[model samples]
Each structure stands twice: as structure tokens, then as C-alpha cells.
Target: MFSATLRSRAASSASLQSRSLATAAAPSSSSSGEPLTHYRITLRRSAIALPMNIKGTLAALGIHRRLQTVFHRHTPDIAGKILTIKELVTVENVPESAVRTKWEQRQERKASRGYEVAGSKLGAEP
Candidate 1:
């Protein structure tokens, strides 16, 4: 039973890695003629309310808030912090010039003239 469980866990881990690799390989566009490499540091999981010492460690590497900042390259110091918060983040690399997806940047426009957004689907037949 134990052996079967371990095998299943290993397979799950391998599948996750494969999916991550696919996301990392998504194409990105470049405008400038300069060569550059890009990386994406995604905060997969986080331990909220970090201890003071841990906060200092993260501050030392310029990361303060959770799920913030997309840096360019992988630095040793950053890698170390990542190790410290290994449970909190998942770092990946992507093209530097990659554009944000349209849906990601779409914000709900506020209603004008005192109109409020009802908590209902727009254009639903009532």
C-alpha cells in the first residue's frame, strides 16, 4: 500500500512539473532589438503574517507584499529568499516582453451618474 501511494505521489509531482513547464514555454513578443531574458515568480502558496526575521529576509531581496513583482532574472540572493519561503512561491521564467492577457487587465468600469453595479449578470433577461 505504501509503495503504491508513493508511486502515485511521484506521478502527480511529475504531472505538475510538466504543466509548469508548458506555462513557462508560452511565447512572448519582443519589440526592442536588445536581447533580454525574463522570469515569472508566482506566489503559489504563502504563510501570511511572516515573522519579523522572515520579513527582513524578504525585504533584503526587495519583496514586501505577497503576489507582487515580476523580476527579470534569477539572482542568488533572490533564490535564497525563495528557498526560505519555498512553501509560498513558485518561480518561473518567461520572455521579458510578454504582454499581459486582455482578461487579466480588464477592470469593471464604474457606473457613471450615481448608477451602481448590481450584483447580477449584465444583459440577463429578467
Candidate 2:
């Protein structure tokens, strides 16, 4: 049992290290060297049974559903809202280019059609 726990911890740490390295390589930024300017906030937990103000805060942040992500500029107001519900979400600093609208996010979630029909066999001359 002890060995199992150690293995899991080691695996998680290794994954964290890899993730950090990946972010370090190609930062999401423009050629002009603009710094990360947005907060990519994803709701990781639901506000069910929580206080009304907490729920209100979530709504103010435009987060209505669990696992829903919202991007907002780095403003004091947004940061305060995030801090209020810090335990319920994950925040990442992202460049402006990384922000996506609802439609774009939905489009990305769709699986691409792997095969495209070029020409019908019957339409082609044998």
C-alpha cells in the first residue's frame, strides 16, 4: 500500500513537470512579445448548496455550468470574483490569442470527419 501511494505521487509529479516544460517551450503570445493577458477560468466544481452570493459571483463571471470555461481580461474585478470562488475553479494565465468564444469552443469540441468523399465510384469512368 505504501509503495502504491508513492508510485502515484511520483507519476503525478512527473506529469506536472512535463506540463510545465510544455508551457515553457512555446508560450501563447504574439510576435511582438505581448505577455499573457487573459485568465482562462474553468469551473471545476458546482455551486450547488453553496451560498447565494457565491452563486451570484459565478454568474457574474459568466460561468453557469460545471466544466465550463470562460476567458476574461486581467482586471481587478475579475480577479476578485475568481478569488471568491477559488476553491471551485481552476485558473490559468493565457495570452489574448488563446481566448475563444462560445461558438469557437463548441466547434473545437466537435470531432472532425476523418474521411472525405472525393468522387463517387459510379460517377467515375471505369
User: Mind sharing the TM-score for model 2?
Assistant: 0.68
lDDT tens readout by residue for model 1, 1-126? 999999989977776777656544333222355344544555555556778767676566456566654453656766677678766666555545542333442432334457767588777887
Q: Tell me the lDDT of model 2 at 34.
A: 67
TM for every model, in the order presented, reads 0.43, 0.68
Candidate 1: list runs displaced more than 4 Å: 1-17, 20-36, 99-126
Over 1-126, each residue of candidate 2 has an lDDT whose tens digit, in order, gives 999999989977776777755433334422247688888899999999999999999999999999999999999999999999999998877888889999999999999899888877886778
lDDT of each: 0.58, 0.86
Distance (Å) between predicted and true CA of 6, model 2?
25
Model 1 per-residue lDDT at 13:
77
What's the lDDT of the predicted structure labeled candidate 2? Answer: 0.86
